[model samples]
Target: MTTPQALVLGIVQALTEFLPVSSSAHLVIMQDYLGFKNPLLLFDVILHAATLGALLVYFRKDIGKIILSLVRLKEKSDEEMLNRKIFYFILVGTIPTLALGLVLNQWIKAMFTSVTFTSLMLLVTGALLWISKRRADSERGIEEMKTTDAFLIGIMQGVAIIPGISRSGATMSTGLLRGIKKELAFRYSFLLSIPAIIGALGLQLREALLEQTLPSHPFPWIGGVLAAAIIGYISLVLFRKIILRKKLHIFAYYCWTIGTISLIIRLAT
Candidate 1:
């Protein structure tokens, strides 16, 4: 890949990864059009790592509290207990997600090659976002969340593994449907993504190691990672504000527009 191509891919990954738009769909389309023959697996692993770093940095305080609570698990202050509970909620949410992802891995991979299918999934994502806009306002926080809520949201996350189904969009929509406050829903969605992204990277890392493939353009890969991390952090901050303002549904229009265009292209071709 060329430097410009790498930078463009990095920007797309960062912008769409946290947005209601699907990053995987954009990457697949871009890769196909650009005719990139490099080891995309390694490149994608690095790009995801960069976004993972952004997530950690953005949620450092929450993560720190979770870690501290775990470290002092037996001390049991009221606040520490609350933190522990929240941590467990995250763990509970990840269970169904991991299970469903493993089961659907091959199906998801196959869908990546079908732009028409991905385009249709984007329409589904847009519909979910639009539906979320009609949900009544909520004030529930992480402490108020139930196990069933977590599991259901996890299932949404798992389903988002399909190309063009935004992970952040699906989880946030599910959270809203479950009566989570908008800001809290957004926060938890990204927080939940930490484990999901890590697990994905771990699996990809193992695959890359086994394949013994490396990027042909190492400098471009490094540039892509840096670009992704920087842009991802900015996007995360902006998304928080958008969610707080209850403007998340605005992204639905974009998804619908893109999906329509993609469908047209597929039909014409």
Candidate 2:
């Protein structure tokens, strides 16, 4: 991709990745408009790694607390215990996500190149966000989370493997619908994605290595990664504040509008 295109794609990825909108869908659309005949899978991996870095930086305090709690296994303070429970819940949530990702691997790859499929899935994401808004206020926190809740959220994350199904949207919406507290649900959704993104990056790297298709000139993509990582941190902070206000459903309108326009344009052409 050209430098300009790379920068634009990075910006789009950063914005959409945090919003309830689907980052994959926006990437596919941007790639198509930028005249990429094939999916930039390797470039995508690099960009994802950048966003993952943003997540790590943004949530470092929470993550550190969890790790510290786990290490001092002797500590029985309520806060430390809650953090430990959250750590286990994240592991439980990753299981179904891994299973679904493996099962849908091929289909997921194909969907990346299909604007029609992505557009349709975007509408589904809209529905999920809208429905989540209707759920009554909940006060449950990490201590109240059950294995079943984690499993169900994992299933939602797995389904989000489809292009245009926002991972954050699906997982967060699932948590909200399950009556989890808003802040906990938001934190858990992104924390759970830590494992999922790592697994995806690893798999993609292995595929590139085995196929001997690694990009020889990766410097062009580095600009994109930097853009994604910087803007992604800002997006994460903005999204968290929005989530706290219980305004996530507002994104559903944007998703619906974009999805419909994409379908109409693609069909007419």
Query: Considering every candidate listed, which one attains the maximal TM-score?
Result: 2
The whole-model C-alpha lDDT of candidate 2 against the native structure comes to 0.90
Candidate 2 scores a C-alpha RMSD against the true structure in Å of: 1.4
lDDT of 1 by residue, 2-102 (tens): 88889989998999999889998878777766776443766777788998998899999999988999998788788898788878878999999999999
The regions of model 1 sitting more than 4 angstroms off are: 37-39, 209-212
What's model 1's overall lDDT?
Answer: 0.87
lDDT of each: 0.87, 0.90
Model 1 lDDT, residue 227, Cα: 96
Per-residue lDDT value at 131 in model 2: 96
Cα-based RMSD of candidate 1: 1.6
> For residues 1-269, what per-residue lDDT tens digits would candidate 2 score against the true structure?
67788899988888888778999999998898788888887778778889999999999999999999999999999999999998999999999999999999998888899999899999999999999987738778877889999999999999999999999999999999999999989999999999999999999977755654645676667788899999999999999999999998988999999999998989999
Give the candidate number with the greatest lDDT. 2
